[model samples]
Target chain A: MAEHEKITMAQAFNQALRDAMTADESVLMFGEDVGALGGVFRVTDGLTAEFGGARCFDTPLAESGIMGFAVGLAMNGMRPVVEMQFDAFAYPAFEQIVSHVAKMRNRTRGALSMPITIRIPYAGGIGGVEHHCDSSEAYYAHTPGLTVVAPATVADAYTLMREAIASPDPVVVLEPKKLYWSKDEVDLDEVQPGIGRAVVRREGTDATLIAYGTSVPIALEAADAAAAEGRSLQVVDVRSIVPFDDETVCAAVRSTGRAVVVAEAPGFASVSSEIVARVTERCFHHLAAPVRRVTGFDIPYPPPKLEHLHLPSVDRVLDAVDTLQWDDV
Target chain B: MPSHDFLPSEQPVQLLDQDGRRVEDPKRAFPSDEDLLRAHEALVVGRRINEQAYALVRQGRLAVYPSSYGQEACEVAAALVLDDQDWLFPTYRDVVSIIGRGVDPVETLTLLKGDWHCGYDPTEHRVAPQTTPLATQLIHAVGVAHAATLRGEDTVVMAMCGDGATSEGDFHEALNFAAVFKAPVVFFVQNNEYAISVPLARQTVAPSLAHKAVGYGMPGERVDGNDVAALLSVLGDAVHAARSGAGPSLVEAHTYRMQAHTNADDATRYRQDDEVAAWQGRDPLLRSKAYLTGRELLTDERTAEIAAKAEAVATVMRDGLMQDVEPVPGDLFEHVHATPTPQLREQAAFLADELSREKVS
Candidate 1:
């Protein structure tokens, strides 16, 4: 086993890019400010100096062009890890992402596979401006051929990014921008679980709290609060969103017979709603009450001053858990 | 240097006039007899493909067909200007170009027939799928060429689009990226007058589509798209320039859309018959045939052989398209990823059970 080092999620992401580029000659990194400026968040800091300009370079500041060319590079057998500077900034490239990047493999009938990884720093809580803090996972998850994953922990951040880069199909890694500074001791060389599998961060019996990305930590914090109040809660981190881990999630829901999905995105037609529906259908007979969801309101992302009220917090999650009908059965 | 150095000529480059007379150029040399004959044969075959695809659309075999009827010169030239290892990124209207690259005629119509997005292996033919969305494929070409350049490979990419696509933001970005990175790519815009009813004037107010390239710091050229000889000469030069790593070049082929945008569209609703008739007089195949015969290179026997080869291709396309392709219900769950997810597996099994139940009923 390798020595474990305490590091931030941002550092872990940088290490993952360095390790992947070191291991494979085809892996490339490029985006608007990803090269010289090392990205706005500095998640890609020092990559250009290490990999040289040929492998890590900046583009012409066009989002659609960045994604469109990444598709081309992937077609030519290069593993391109592109960065969308912010969540809302990715809208310009949505057509390319939805039309080409997501459907290229299926469109080619397996003849061509896009081994492209798009890293988006998403979700609110860091008091950034409006566009900087959007939870846009539902858009990517709704697309069939794409693999959407969000890592909340430092360890999963490193391992999941490496996994996304190595996958044959395109993967959208929604890095929690608010959690970029969150740190933990992680084994850099340790192999974690692959994509499409959820991890149970904390196990309990009273109810299950399902969350991912920015919501995972909030759910865990709510679980801790619930434990002090004489109610045990299980936290299921839905690491993968597209090829959703129904086995682990449903098993957790069935065991607890209650679930409350938490997310920072609006609840209307969102991933949280999907999780609630899936839990209802699979754990209907075992449930003590209907599944509930605590999410951001159905409105545009609020300004930083009002973001705390807009984002799902520990109190919001526990309040939803309180509605899971603890006294019904 | 002044912008005029990058601007296209007052008139499009024409090697052979519409009357089949050779136009002398001090800076450019005409193609050889062999290349002319080859291009003429491809023009004939490409015209037959358009005609056959029209018939297929009428027969309800193909869902829709976007005929490259008047643009055969540009299509054929775009395909012939590439090496076997070079990549060709084509649009939906460039089936003739795909055929010129030797893709199976039947496989080329797979997307139109609604059987699959692309039937042939892209790697096998070095052709990207015939992109339906406008101007998106151009950036892909830049990416491929950039990759090749990075790896020290001598691969050039030819990206095809129409006059209207030049107005897209992607077009601007693609040209800028290709020039900035010095990626070996040729932006081939077949200025075929309209994009499904929208004319060039509505699309852009530029002096000419090719002149727009100068803003991106790359040389741009315009050619008489209906003159096969000129198309071959100009596109050939652009491809060679890209292959030699002189960076990207934009070539705008001035032509007309002789037919409606597709079989579903009504050309009469937008343009007058006189306009379409005027372009017919400058038909690519007619001009190519006259030039070839004038050069003593196209004899009756060779013409008949070429026509027969075209008929064989049409026959193959008809036979292949007429066959009913059964959709495999289970295939819906395949290829979404390298490995099927547990949810997909459960859904596949549920679908299978439903199908078996329907059969038992």
Candidate 2:
């Protein structure tokens, strides 16, 4: 057994990049401030020093250029891991992401594969200003030919990052910025489940709370609160959003007969909405009540001071749980 | 060297004037007689391909065709400049250039025919899919060239765009990154006077498109785009410099889109006929033929042979495209990923059931 060490999600991510680069000579790391400055969040700290500048260097401040070239590099047989710095900042590269990075394989009829990983620091908890915090996973999740994953635990963060880099297709890693400093004891060598599989964070049978990325910990907290009130609320972390683990999610919903999808992104026509629709269609007979969604309001991310009012809170999840029609019980 | 050294000359480079008279360029040399003859033949074939594509669009065999009717010089030269190991990144209008790279003419029209996103294998042909979004492929070219440099390969990438594309932000970013990293990329801008209906004046206020490259600290050259001999010589020089590690260069080929943006566009809505007639006097094929005959490099027999070859290619394209394409419903689920998700599998099955039901009806 490998020794377990207490580390933050940021450290886990940094270690993952270092390990992937060390393992594959073709793996490269580049983006704005990813060099000696080690990314704005320092998730890429010490990588440039460990693997010379040629392997881990900083790119010019151009998001579209960074993504566009990453596609080219991937086409030429290099595994490139690019950092988007922040969630909102990735919008400049949206055309490249949707048009080329996401469609290159299908566009060429599988003649070319884009083995590129785009890491975006997403969601809001810390009182950072607007644009610094956004749950932009919905955009990536909606695009085809892209594998989107968000890891809530330290162990999953490391393992998922490694898997994302190793995948032959493009993967979008939505790292929770607010959880960067959250610490957990984890064995670095312990490989978690691969992408496209949901894991149950907390087991129960009364109702299921489905969440991902920054919302997983919040869902767990809400479940703990429910437990004190004699309710057995289950938590299912939907780590992968695109190739959604429909089997696991549907099974969980069927077992509980109720589901409340959770995320920081706005609920209207979002990944949360998609989840609710899928749960409704697949578990229509098993469902006890209408599937509910506890998500951010359908508005632009709020100012830092009022973000608490905009983001989904434990009270909101419990309130949604109450609406799931416990009258039958 | 100072950045000013990279500025384009006051006059665009020219080997043959519009009258097919040889103009002396102290810094540039004419291509060998053999290369010139080959380039002329390619120009002839490229123009024929454009004509046939127009006919296909009228016949409803193709959804639309962006004819590179008058830009044959830039199209053929860009393709002829690269070695077999090199790669060419082309735009939607660069089908002539794509075919000149030895890609099958029928496969080149696949996207326009609406049969597939791309009809041929990019890796096998060393040509990228015809990119529709302007200036995006430039960055891809830079990245590929940079990768080749890292792997210690002598591959140079020729990225083709237009005058209007140079106004895009990705264009500037690509040039800046290529120069900073010293990637082996040549950005060939075919300044065909119009991007759809928008004229060059509406695109940029810069003195010239090639002059924009000086800001990125790379050498820029402007060539007479209608003069195939000039395009071949100038692009050949740029490619050679990149292959030898002189870093990236930007070459702006001065030309005109003699045809409308596409068969769907009405040229009379944007410009006067006189403007088109003026450029017709500078036709690339006419100039190439005149120069070849003047230099005694072209014989009647050679011209007939070239014309026959062009006709054969056009016939093949017509025959291949006239055949109905078989659509596979299951192919939609394939190639989305190496392994389809459970959701994708379920969706695929549902689609299959629906298709079968329709068949019964």
Candidate 3:
């Protein structure tokens, strides 16, 4: 294996882009400010310089155009990666993303496959407020023809991106904006576990904590706090939201018989809601207590100063975990 | 505006006048008599299919059909101009165009019959699914054409939309993208005057829909939609320019909707019969046939033979549509993705078990 190096999630994402572009001549990147500015998060930094403007260039500030253009590019056998700038900024292009990009392959009866990846810096916690930070994983996850995923670690940031690019279906890669600078030691030559599979990042014997994207770190922090109290907890990171790794989640929840799901999106019709429902459905008999969810409020994302109150903080997650019954313990 | 003057005399381009008289433009050369006869034959078939599909919809054998009865010349010419390597992005109203492109009529009606997501396989044919949403395919066409250009494929893509669709943001985006990137694509807008109940003037205030293309920094031209020779020449030129890397162009064909939007609409509420009668004089099928007769390409026997061929094709399509299909309940989840999700998988299994138990009982 190659040398192990510590890098931030942003760096890992940039490396993945470089790797993808270098590997395939048909791969190209286009979006607002993705070119010379290297994206607002700088996740696409240095790509334009290395790949040349033809392969990596800026486009007019139109999200629908970017998405529609990407869909067409993929249909014509080119791999197109689009950066939607921010979670909320992508709403303008939601029609193209959902109606055309997501349904193209299915509508064409599998004759047309769009191998396109859309990268949106998502979720609140960076204090950007409004359109800058919003969690939209559920919208895409609910979509059938799309593959939705988010990276919680630097290694996953690099690996999941390449996997998304290589996949034959349209993939929505929700980059955890709050964790963009989160760093970890990653082996450059490690055998990738692949996308669409969940992993047990931490193990415990008590309640199982289910989360994806930004919630993974929060869930992990809550687990650590639980460990201090001598209440063991397991952390399950559902990297892929739509075709979620049901086996890992069901197994963990079934074993513990208690669970708490975490997310940054609203509690209403949210991804966290789906996780809790599934856990309850599969582990109903084994459950010691009802599964709880710690998520953003149903209201629109509040102002920056109020974001902490609106987001599911570690304390909020631990509170949900605390609700699990200890009678069996 | 870069010295390409196809919009002369403030009238749409036409090689043969509506009266079947020669009115050729010196600047634009005409196609050969052989080519004209071939176009006439294709238009005849296209118009016959249009008529038969309407009848099927009326008889309740088919659910809905968008007849391109008045715009057959533009529809047939659009398909005839493109090389098979090129792609076509058609809207719901462009079924006649798909049939003109050699896609099976029965397959093209599957979507209208509410049978499947798309009637024909996009890979098997160069035509994309006939999208119902206006102007959405325009952007998709630009995207696919741009990708082809990037890969150095000598292919052009065409997207068909109506006059009202020019008002959509996607149309603006498609033209602008094509112009900026020099994408090998063409935007074909058949200005048939109405979008369901909405008229063209209500959609845009531009002097002409072709003017919208000039604003996008691309060449735009208007053609007599009823004249097969004019449509063939204009569309062929645009496709050639795009394939040769002259970037994208917009061609607006002036035509009319001879039938209601679909079998459901009542056109009498919007326009008078006199207006419809005025357009009938410029019928695309009749004008082309008259032009062919003048050149002695269409004899009385040959006309009868063409009518028989068209009737046979329609009969086959009708019989195919009348056949009942065996439904697999699992197909509900099949095209949803390359692989169904865990939730869908569980539901599909549950359905399969319930059906098996019902059969056993």
Candidate 4:
């Protein structure tokens, strides 16, 4: 076992990829700028030099070709972790991810399985231009044959990458760019389980704040603020977005009776919206107030100054929590 | 990344005379007469299936169908190049190719019948669904070839497309990828002169479409698509080269569409009657009959027997089309996703309710 040391979220991702590559010869990485440049966010730093081009390299600037070739490579018994430079830039390859990568096994009646990892640097906190700051995880989560996940901290980043690589299905791992520089203690040597399960970050009795990716930190901050204000707030980190730790969500919402869903994606028809709808239906009898969502506004991710307004902040989460009918008793 | 070395130049290969006589060429040696006779029998079956499909369109059984009325020779010839284990990626016009490859005619109609997906299993038949999105399947075929090579399998992927598909980005990418990786694939471009409405001259600036293969570092050749013997020889050579690890090859089959593109297309608007008459004189089936008569292989009674068998096959297919088939609405949701998501399940349930209400009304 390795000693736990605080490291940035980007470094954790880099270490996770390195650890996984060392353990399994099947793990390979490829994307534009992932080679000598260490990836745009440096999540894949030193990988190309360590593993050589056969195991890690840069592909043509064609997104569809990269994903389509990864599908071929995975079908041929190689686990390829593809980097989609930014979340918004992954649209060109969306068809491949949706049509072929997700559907290959089902189409072939289990003859083929796509154990590919698609790493996306997503969310809108970096002030990166329009194409770089989109939270497109909901579009992928909506697609079947794919598992969607996001890690809000260093420890989860390390564990989730390894878990996603080992799964027998395609996985889309979105790394919130804003949290990439944030540091936390993580055990580098410990192997992690599959990323299909969610984690309860904080315990409380009054209400539950469910969030994933960038919003996890906001929910944590909001929970602390609520605790100080004499309100009990249970915070749940929905690490897996697609298979959606529905069991955890249902249990948390039922116990608390009040829920606030949070996400970096827009509130209109976003992943958070889906969560609220499902929770409302399943936990309808256990409700104290209509489920409120603190999320990005229904507009294109605006400029840097406006992005802070668009994204869900701790203040927004608290505001949503305050709307609950606590005085009804 | 040498500029000139990027693509290999193309050379067209033709072994049959306009009159359908096989030329004496060692490079174009074909199978024995018994093999050709078997192929001829298959061609008859394919023609019957095609005729039935054409009539189905008229009877409102199918949404649309592009008939290969006079291009049966090209379809059958391309399909005959491979064993059942080999793969084929065909376009929408390759109806005869599908039938020649042993697919049931009824299953082929499943696509135009608005059956959500391709009619047959690609892995089971090694024939991908007929690609309606132009040359996208070209790249997929190359990917399959790459997979086969990595697995150390000696299989050839035959990807068929039209002259118009050459204009697509997918075709360019597929050619480049295949050449760079030395993927075991053959690109069969059926140059049917017109791409719906645009003529070949308007499609490319090169003297011959086969010459475009030079850009991809592959051997490109031309063949008379209307001549079954020529098409078989050319495609067979390409397939052999691919299977033997010689790398990719492109075969440009010079053919012409005799019928309207579909029931909806009117070729008379762009093409003159004189042009159509000239090609009609060189009818591939008639030329085959002439050659068979010259070889003392076709008797009046044998010809009548072949015609009668073709008619019977057509009758069977037509009868099948007439029978009422109330398509189950539930089937639409079954294959949309391998395992339907919770959202998809909800959508399916919702649609089912709506459909049931309509039924009651």
DockQ of predictions, in order shown: 0.84, 0.84, 0.74, 0.27
| Candidate 3: tens digits of C-alpha lDDT, residues A1-329 | 46677899999999999999999998899899988999888988999999999899998788888888987888788999999999888987888988888887777677888889999889878878567888888888887788999889898999999999888888899999989999888984576667778999899889898888888988999999989999899999999886788888999988888888988899999888888887888789989999998889998888899988998888998888877876665
For candidate 4, write residues A1-329 as lDDT tens digits. Answer: 55677899999989889988999887889888999999999999999889887677887677777787787566556788999999889888887788778877655446567889999999988887767799998799888778889988788898888888877788899999999999987776655534657788999999999998999988999999999999999999999887677788899999999999998788887899999998999999999899999888888889877788888889989999999988866
Q: Which residue pairs show backbone clashes in model 2?
A: none
Strongest candidate by lDDT: 2
* Interface DockQ of candidate 4: 0.27
Cα lDDT, all candidates: 0.91, 0.93, 0.86, 0.80
Rank all candidate structures by their DockQ, best first, as comma-separated numbers: 2, 1, 3, 4
lDDT of 4 by residue, B246-353 (tens): 898888888888888888899999998888888886666766666666777777887778778777767766776666677767765554444554556777899999
Better of 1 and 4 by lDDT: 1
Residue B90 Cα positional deviation in candidate 2, in Å, after optimal superposition:
0.5
Docking class of 1: high
Q: Model 1, B158-231: lDDT tens per residue?
A: 99999888888999889999999999999999999998998889998889998988999888999999988888
Backbone clashes in model 1, listed as residue pairs = none
Clashes of 2: 0
Any runs in candidate 2 off by more than 4 Å, and if so which?
A1-3
lDDT of 2 at A287: 91
